[model samples]
Target: MRPINEIIVHCTATPEGRPVSVAEIDAWHRARGWSGIGYHRVIDITGARLAGRPLSAVGAHCAGHNTGTIGVVYVGGLAADGRTPKDTRTPAQRRALAAELMELRDRFNIRKISGHNEYAAKACPSFDASAEYDHLFEGRERLFKPIVDHLLQRGDAGQFAQSWRDQLITWRENRNQPSPLLSSQDPDDLFGHAVEAETLAFQRERQIVADGVVGPQTRNEMRLALNGRPPFSALENYQR
Candidate 1:
């Protein structure tokens, strides 16, 4: 309701295998003479996402940036020794967190997602979240047409079928050294050998067949690799 724009992840800093609940977190905050839990949500060891503070109110999780952001706190962040900071998220928690974040992005039009360590030095989440999950923030769309549609059945020369070539070039180039020029110059058609080679290389990198054809399989693999970003409205068309 406060025009949420960012989703921040945090850790409870508790030791691995320890069980903590939202009720306990609420009591902790109440003891401090504040509202209930500071975060909008809490994820437990088994990856159960629970509600905490209401979305209608400003959160108390992050120090200075709580006004326009949502906070998600996982139960564990410490190592087995219970002192050293470590990413102790379980596999279930990882999946649950991704799903929860996706839902939040769709509902609140979230633009950016980051870990607590990005804003503070304490390594609250104990991992480089932004770098690791960068692909998830890239808005990747599935190709509506098959790659073979653009290729000439008899010869290698053909018009391109994909309009996402520009986006693909941008995405792939950002991952590696700048090519000075993109392999695909035409946004609407495949017109260059460099583009074909680049497509082949991308297929190889994704472990798919290196046929240099951007077909359904290639498009699916690309979508998976990109993981997509928040909805377009979340960043550009957001009314707030």
Candidate 2:
């Protein structure tokens, strides 16, 4: 597994799905006077996973985590018909991403799955990867499910996303195993720890120098990450 443990996601901010070569992507980054294409992979509109900067090279994707994690960019930001039309990823792209993630998981034995929202304050990827997020934090405790339903307000959102919530629970458990850090004793009254951790992860991923605190922008990322996944009709424990 090459000491692998985390999967970080990003968005191209455009749905063009234009297959830009790695060299070209690098050139663009150079023009900006920045490092290289910040991610480990890029999934185009057709769902083709364009392998990007090598993980060994230390990517520019997620803020601080870039030092020790792999990054993937899915074409287009994830909020569909979002604050702007630019924020949508094609269904084909989504399928490609699922495949890529599965492959990466198998090949690298990656443990944590988190969106840009989880790492830092910015909504770089624009899509939700909450199931993985939940999994990363909760691990294998039976209490994971109950925790997700409470944190995400499960009954209000659709079934597909809720399913991911469960997947997050399972995915989290598979990689890290149980730890007291995810103790059921924590207060679930409001955002509190959930919001705090998400904010901190975002701050670190985005490389934004700031203490972790939930604000308007952070809240937006939370909504996007939690709401982006499909709410399949067959999902169980879905309230509405």
Candidate 3:
């Protein structure tokens, strides 16, 4: 599969309540001397997801950043006047968009979700999609703050270590992975060798640095794993 790392959201720019089909979009793009519908996916007023350009082909939606990106467009972005930009997404469309984005993110390990306005001067999506979907890329960072702050390791023994162990156990159990703590060992507040070994295994599985220490990235990955989401990509320098 081609490497995909970003999802860009757009709108049809049609008036509110007007329905536009993917075939119509395809004809429109063809008239403009393009292949077909530029977006990878389209959502209509009824919140139905329609296939557009095949994902194997690079999208033609964005001007310069088509490669390694998927374009998703919702049906309407205009007010009743059909000129002014507005967020015309209905409740169903909102839910559908969120579900689509989450599925795409997990499938492709997408690094960023952006609105068309983020790249251009016009308000194509008519809303702040990036800010609205920010939580989709985040982990339970606040819940893992204690482990992150203390940097738990083998020699550590405290409530924080115990909390980490508890979370790790939950993560393992959720995935049906064998628990690292021995059966004879009590659930104590200690980060022992077994914990360290398990930490290394988890880090390796998540594609994180296998340092056997609970740092910020490790904790974030752990939280995401426990929540049934994949870890973030290692492209730390990615802008968004």
Candidate 4:
């Protein structure tokens, strides 16, 4: 794993109460010719923790400061008008964000927690993340294992399954290749035939083993597809 020392927070810049999926963000970044989503993690309106770029890779969220930093984004920053910046974090989002920051701080021994506004001339994140989370750096116990570690396959249900399905659906939409199977499914929490078929299709497209199961390799490839490959040359410069 790459050494990490900082966590930078950002906002999706979407209007309040608007739901933004991790895949949608990835598609946006990809439209800019980037590999995928710039942040490493995303917190949705319902406080769902969505994965973005892998922790081992450098993020594209910050210019000239991507190295050794993990990028985290919450789903909303814009007010109802969608023009002005605001602290639109829901109560659940606030709790979730604090928990996530504490976990990362302990897990990575992070030294800093900052907002995008601190680094650029933008009102991203819409709040003082550094000041809010300054106490996280005091000290804490670390977790020995990652938060989630289970292969998503047919018959699985709940938040993780739903999150992955959301990502798959968004990716297909972004590619302008909508999946009829996925479209017909409601609730989107169950890993049924539609999800399995789409998973198989994605694996084939990525040229990985088409097992139709979301294992470690498949998950990594999904992230790679979203973020593109790591810029080794740029990382080398940052390291030096």
lDDT per prediction?
Answer: 0.67, 0.52, 0.78, 0.77
CA RMSD for every model? 17.6, 17.4, 16.4, 16.9
Most lDDT-accurate candidate: 3
- Residue-by-residue lDDT tens digits, candidate 4, 44-133: 999987778777876768755666688999999999999999999999999999888888887887877778898889999999887788
Best to worst by TM-score, what's the order? 4, 3, 1, 2
Per-residue error at 31 for model 2, in Å?
Answer: 2.5
TM-score of each: 0.56, 0.49, 0.58, 0.59
* CA shift of 201, model 3, Å: 56
Candidates 1 and 3 compared by lDDT, better number: 3
Worst 10 residues of 2 by lDDT: 231-240
Best by TM-score: 4
List model 2 lDDT by residue over 1-240, tens digit each: 224566777776643545445555555654543334667787866677776665554455654565446788777673444345344667787788777777776676565677887767877676577564444334523332110111232123455434433433333344454322333344233433443454465445433323554332233333444555321111122122
lDDT of 3 by residue, 38-92 (tens): 7888889999977787776656687656766789999999999999999999999
Which is superior by lDDT, 1 or 4?
4
Tens digits of per-residue lDDT for model 1, 39-151: 88888999998887776655667755676778899899999899999899999999988888888878876667788887778889888776666566565212211111123
